[model samples]
Target: MDFDYDLFVIGGGSGGVRAARLTAQDGHKVALAEESRMGGTCVIRGCVPKKLMVFASEYPEAIGYARDYGWDAKVGDFDWSAFSGHMRSELDRLEGIYETNAQKAGVKIYHGRATVEDAHTVKLGNGQTRTAKHILIAAGGHPVRPDMKGGDLGMVSDDVFNLEALPRKLLIVGGGYIGCEMAGIFNGLGVETSMMIRGAQILRGFDEEARGHIADCMGRRGVTIHTGCAPVEIEKRGDRIWVKGSSGHQDEFDDILWATGRKPNTQGLIAEGVGVKLDRRGAICVDDYSRTDVPSIHAIGDVTGRVELTPVAIREGIAFHETVFRGNKTPVDHELIPTAVFTQPEMGTVGLSEEAACEQEPTLVYATAFRPMQQAFAGGEERVLFKMLVSKETDRVLGVHIVGPGAGEMIQFVGVALKMGATKADFDRTCAVHPTMAEELVTMKEPVRVLD
Candidate 1:
């Protein structure tokens, strides 16, 4: 059957863009439709902008540390207007690059909302329909406000980058990475920040000890963290937002931000009409090869709810092209992916957490917590943690977790080692770099605990 194009991508996120570009580069006719900005969540709203904010917030702390090093240093008030203007400008540049790259690869770009009319047809917002031999869905997710009274009074993570002015006092809800990281960013920027979590601790499902250290450090750094409580109601009182907590405590803040969670963006795409299967969470159900129930349709990235990281999405797209176009079967490997949380103290972890490792095997934990030489000499109360989980029977490093400065950068290198099946002996034999926080990873000797 003749079609308008060989492939039609319904979203222009990292996953969709890569797939479209690669398929087009393979000499297939391809077109991509994006209703919003080309860069999607990571570049425009999620990781890129958020990390920039994190870097901006860290300057004040660095200035303070400078004073201890015998330099006369003082912190100036953060200028939100100036910083936000530059941030938006940078995002615009990145979005243009994404569009230009896709165009260079010979993929036609359509800037409008698109919905599936059938397994092989996509209808754009401007009253035009395009037919293709195959269709790909990679529309990402959006942060969702919790269902509660006066929920509209609160904002989500997306609204953070667009605030007219930084709040003098901010109340953040949830205990996940988004919530914790935002709390740190705002607190460092001189906002009186507070957070409420339903769970007993922040960063649930992570390395418990690492998260505990971060929570403690954040509290010491002036974030009013309330665990085992959530907002029951939010009310607007003049310019301030009043929140009633589950613990019966009430407070008022200049703004309330909800970092509760995100939902798959499968709503308006008409997946149901095309007989595509959706999971309970609204994510598209796909096979190992990213093919949906309809052979002509496929889904990847956050929309599929499988390892919703940006890099993972790109890998999935590569695998899809290999299987369908290059005639080589490829499946995305989701195991042992390293992740970092940009909290003030920071956290980088890979492989498995001690809690998760113990559930699977007899695990031995080697852990250390101490004031690093720099912080100790500078007379700061800050300390760093280095921990490794090893399989008792095999002497293989089951996990590596670090909480300190440069943890994110450290985990990226450690992730490679773990991926290569590096064991405890491999780490023990490697020489350590002197006068560094990361040296602790290879220096810890005895097992702190053994869980049978």
Candidate 2:
């Protein structure tokens, strides 16, 4: 059947943009509808802006280290106005780039909400209906705020980037990566930051040792972390917000930020009405190739609730293009993905955690925790950890986890080795770069413990 376009993509996130651009580049007609900005969460409100804040927050520590190194360095008051203005400008430029690139690739841009009318039809908010041979949904997700009394007075991660001024006292809720990262950023920016975790520990899904080290570092850095507790009620009194914790504690703060979690963006798309299967979390259920239950429809990125990372979404989009356009029948490989949490010290990990490794089979753990030369020389008490998990029988490195500076960059290279199935002997055979923290990866010859 003849349609208005070959592809009609709902949402302009990383995955949606990539799919539209590439499919159009292949000479197929495409139209993309985005209710909001072009760059979606990662480029606009998420990774880019958040990472910039993380960099901004690290300056005070850098100044301290500079002073310790005998360089005359002092940190002045942070200028929130200047930084936020510049950040908005940067975001605008990035959004323009996304739009320009999509236009250059000959994809039609509809700047309004789009809903699925059927497997091959979409109705935009502007009272226009467009039909396509295929439809791709990449609507992404949004941060969730708890449904409680006076919760509307609190802010979410998105709201943090738009704050007019940094609060003198900030209360961050949730124990996930977002909460931990924001706590670190606010604390470093000289805000009296306190984190309320409903669970016993933060970063619940991460490696236990790495999460514990991060919690300790955050606490040492002056973040009042309250674990196994949560705010039962929030009250706003003029400029101050008061929180009553489940553990019978109460406090007032200038800001209350909820980093609780995010939910899939499938509200008005009507995927289920058009025979698309949705999981319990409202994420569209798709096969390995990102094809939805309906043959003419597909979904990717956070909307699919599979590997909710930007890079993963891009990869899935590329795979979808290959399978549909290039006749390559490619499926996204979502295994052994290396991830990093940008807390104060940072945590980078790949493959299995120690718990997962031991649960599977006999495992040998090689681990070390000590003060690194740089911090030690600076007369700082901060320490770093590097750990490796290896299978006793296969001798293959099962996992590598690091909690320290440069852990993120280090894990990127380590991820390549793990992806190539490098064994413990392979790491041992590699020569050590002397006096570097990463050298321990190659030099740790003896197992700290072997799990039977």
Candidate 3:
């Protein structure tokens, strides 16, 4: 059928942009609609800006290393307001880049929300119905605050980016990555930070070693972690917030951040008109190659909830082009995906946890622990832990986990190898680079791996 555009993308985030650009390159007209900025959550309010804060938070945490090495250095105090202002400027700069790239790729950018009017038609907020051969939903996700009264209890991850200033005392009300990250951030910046996770540990879905190392390190830095606790209410009490919780514990703080989690941003998409299937969390259900149940309609990124990370969205979008519009027709397998959590000490991991791997194969465990080379020079009592999970009989590495510096960077290649069924032998045969955190992955002796 002749259409206004070959593809109509209902998001301008990483996934939406990728789909629009690559599909456009495939000799098909593509138009993408975004209600706000060109960049989705990551470029706008998500990974990029958030990680910049994490990076800024790390400087203070790592500065102690210089002093520990007898470099008589006293890092000056951090100005929370200054960090906020700098981040705003950086985000502004990034917003423009996202806009220009889309234009250069010959993808029509619609600066308004899009609603699915039918299988091939999207009605933009500007009251125009654009029809296409295919429709892609990459609307992304939004932060959901905790159920509380006085809604002023706290702000979500999105609000943190727009902070007028950082609070000296932070009360993080969730145990997800955002909570773990911000808890580390404020505490590292010399603020008195407290974290309240309903479970025993923060970062529930991540590998245990990653959570363990972050929890231990954050504790060492004096961030009070309240586990097995859930906040019941949060209200301002003069200069502080009185937070009451399910555990009957009460705390007071100047700042409160509710990083409970995020929900799919589909409230006004009119998805029903196109018969798109969404799960209970509001995520569109997609098949192996990111196609929705309805053939002409597809979804990716946080909107799909298959993989919530930024890189995953980008990969899915790129793969959509390869698998659908392009001749390659490649499918995406989400297994062995490398990920990182930038908490106190930082962590990176790729593949299943030992427990999950063992569940698949009863006796698969590969665990290792040692101090990093930097720790040797930093003269600090810090030890980096590493773990791997592999099929005992097959010896095929199933997972690789790292907790230390450069974790996020090191795990990318590990993820590639693990995805290709790399065995412990492959890791062993690789020569180690001297004096690097990644060298530990190759040098560690594989003893009997233990399950979590």
- Report the Cα lDDT for residue 325, model 2: 79
RMSD, candidate 3, Å: 1.9
What TM-score do all the candidates reach, one by one?
0.98, 0.98, 0.95
Window of ten residues with lowest summed lDDT in model 3: 443-452
Local distance difference test scores for all models: 0.92, 0.92, 0.82
Candidate 3 residue-pair clash tally? 1
Question: RMSDs, each prediction?
Answer: 1.0, 1.0, 1.9
- Where is model 1 more than 4 Å wrong at Cα? none
lDDT of 2 at 275: 92
Query: Cα deviation in Å at residue 312, candidate 2?
Result: 0.5
Pairs of colliding residues, candidate 3 = 365-449
Clashing pairs in 1: none
Better of 1 and 3 by lDDT: 1
- TM-score of decoy 3: 0.95
User: How much does candidate 2 score in TM-score?
Assistant: 0.98
User: How do the residues 328-391 of candidate 2 rate in per-residue lDDT, one tens digit apiece?
Assistant: 9998899999998899899999999999999999999999999989889899999999999999
Off by over 4 Å in 2: none
Is candidate 2 or 3 superior in lDDT? 2
